[model samples]
Target: MTQYQPIAAAAAATEWWRGAVIYQIYPRSFADSNGDGIGDLPGITARLDHVASLGVDAIWLSPFFTSPMKDFGYDIADYCDVDPIFGTLTDFDRLLDRAHALGLKVIIDQVYSHTSDRHAWFQESRSSRGNAKADWYVWADPKPDGSPPSNWQSVFHGPSWTWDGRRGQYYLHNFLPSQPDLNIHNPDVQEAILDTARFWLDRGVDGFRLDAINFSMHDPSLRDNPPVAPGAGPRRRPFDYQHHYYNQSHPDIPTFLARIRRLLDSHGGRFTVAEVGGEQADREMKLFTEGFDRLNSAYGFNFLYADALSPELVRHTIDLWPGAPGEGWPSWAFSNHDAPRHVSRWAAPAERKACAALSMLLLMALRGNVFLYQGEELGLPQADVPFELLQDPEAIANWPNTHGRDGARTPIPWAADAPHAGFSPARPWLPVDPEHVPLAVDRQEEDPDSTLNLTRRLVALRRREEALRCGIIRPLDLAAPLLAFERGDGPDRLLCLFNLGRAPADWRLPEGWTVIEAVGGEATGGSVPPLAGLIARRSA
Candidate 1:
């Protein structure tokens, strides 16, 4: 018997996220409505048709809730309400209705670890020691010398603890000082989070992508982190000088994940994916989604942070997720708002187009669910954001040493000739790059051979073939630069191969195999051209 059944049936069985193609939308850069220089829910609603045309199953919207925009919506001020800048709650409802009508599931970002300084919860928690929500956030007394409680450093800058005069104590902030860490160990806080989840679930949300989930809980003892060994790598900031043991990845995370899963399960059909980033991300990811009682999936920074994409890198990343019973399904994305684009990281000046095509094809062919970032389909390279225009805090602070994430977050050009490339009537928060104008969606829509079309073809193949959708992957033994794998080896089988080197790699399409999709130069039976990929199938 073959695992070649129609994927549509499996999709209808409430496990649509298992092998679904999720497109990530960085709301601020995706589209702008109201001529306010920022993308809003209405803007996203208008673009849903374009997204649906790409054949993706869902969209993972980045944070867009009520916030101060200090960390660009990650520092959520209100988890249950829509931010005014983005739009009103009514606007979000409209967007959801439109997306569901298009047969596209919608998932939103949930930042559980922290809340913005402007959030009512944080404000109350900081008001006084005896307030009802005084202990809702993590707070610790300072050391004898009035320094931070521990050596834990924040991801953005200096110490993780900030002095709060109101409480006469120091509060934990794993990111910006304005974003206070939630005390998930507190039972009241857990219930509060669950209530928040229910609020959205009641509104008919399909899922949530938990942000920095591992940071939701911390060691109650307030212990210092272990110092890093000498010369591990270049210490970018104080945060890089420690092993990050006590401050994050607490054992209680899985228990909370079980609570989250149970809550979503109560909703009958929903999805949950965690974003776990750190040195122990792999271990934490497995633990968080280890069984049926936890999250449905989790994605690490494997491909997102890799300096180069290669056969060995893909092989190593795939091997981590077995896709077997009892093992959690893995979700993958090469680029997101937080990281630089893959083409920028993997290819130089002239090779971005080929690199983008190859990576897109490869992402869709993988065994588990995959996410495609906005603008990736257009083969848009990372825009050059100089110091004067840099918006990302980390990038601004680490200028020259690090290019940061702003380059990859430039506004997506809709029309090649329009002012601001049709992004908005007014200037966008992020400038539209001149180089990206030629790669606009409208321009690609006019060319059948464009990377955008390649994405559509590849995505259509994923939807049409069970082998590429939900089938198990088996790596084929091949020399360097030639990565090959088999999907659904029984019937309706597939052999997906990629040539990652500068030169073409030889490969013969097995007898009786039919080409499904090919991209990047000629993907003929004789060879897979450099920076190319081929998906071929065999039918009984």
Candidate 2:
């Protein structure tokens, strides 16, 4: 085992997350300590050493809350306890202790947008119209014709409103019918959510990744969403047919965020990042993180759900947040539990390795906090999950048309030779991608040129260079297939360039710049090799 020192111990206690690299761990697929074939908190604790070895500042865990697993763990049955599938609260404490001991911060997902229909609050809310919790969820009487309140559509398809016979009214569910949207507009509901945050903070969690936070508060009027503009592309599901204005991104969400921030401030050094995605994500992300009173950071689907990683796309997204006064900080992620792997999405068969390396270099060079998905360091491609074994609700509901998210949520391959790729003692929950076996961690640890090792080096470089951390990004005017930028902070300055194209491209270096680090390909003779990335600094 490699000896590790906690990086947080040496850094400023507050704002440590600024420009930090956070590794996202999907607990259910990361590791399974018990032979039950499902990952538990103890499994995560046992793997803290591997996470620490990557030199990440913190780990953002997907939800492990008590749930009925309808939308996996997103449909929370209880706010304060871990599901039996993920172990008890004691198991979570152990994971936290082990993480902090290794110098890694632990940030868990806080899904305040909705809860499992099985949740006590929802149960009580649906029991009777006059019940104490009746208003805790978004429930409304049907329109005069007994149809849904508006043209709102659920993310999983069909109407967002589900008629509940128990309450003689319709209940709102932005996702699956079983995952009812919480009425955060209700003060009592807000208080209950804040108390849940207090529970985790009191247990020593470093911060929270607010899941689908923009959906926390909906338009109280229940107005219909306007139809999308013509040529908006084919609508795969009913959810994509409208502008989604009245259904989400309500104007009052920031006020609720301020409350969450106030609660976090009381805990000291606690961080909060909101997950904001939609057609109006850029606008809402800014609103949610506009000032110190709101979230610390926000990330959208600019790159995560993108089909291509183009230079123009990179420039456009980075331009959204320039670290200006009153603008909240931004975070960037190329892949996550909910999206397809970038390696498979962006790279051709021959260029997967190069593209993976280039992606990491670009992620670190960008002017914001960065997130690395669990198996991304290993260059894992999207798994091929057949229809019969598919588990995602949205995917199953819109089969054949939607690729689904299960391909990206497969278990991490720990050993190339071990059964189930060393993710569990028995068969894993999701089948391992056969292609990922060769890219397993045990195999890559010995290969100097492997993506795993390269990722570690890039992470370390980001930590060592102040210019790459909290620096201003100045994008250079370049042609398609090539993205160039300069990051500068104080006396430190660095030039970063990437050849996003498959064929080699060349560019003359400006005066005083010399290559400091080159990987995946070369930056020799003022030329960039295919899928190459180079970082340069002014010559002394």
Q: How many steric overlaps are in each model, in order?
A: 0, 1
Report the error of model 2 at residue 116, Å: 0.4
Give the lDDT of residue 89 in candidate 2: 94
Which residue runs does candidate 2 get wrong by more than 4 Å? 1-13
Per-residue error (Å), model 1, residue 67: 0.9
Indicate the residue-level lDDT of 532 in model 2: 86
Assess every candidate by TM-score.
0.96, 0.97
Residue range with the least summed lDDT across 10 consecutive positions in model 1 = 1-10
TM-score of 1: 0.96
Model 2: lDDT equals: 0.89
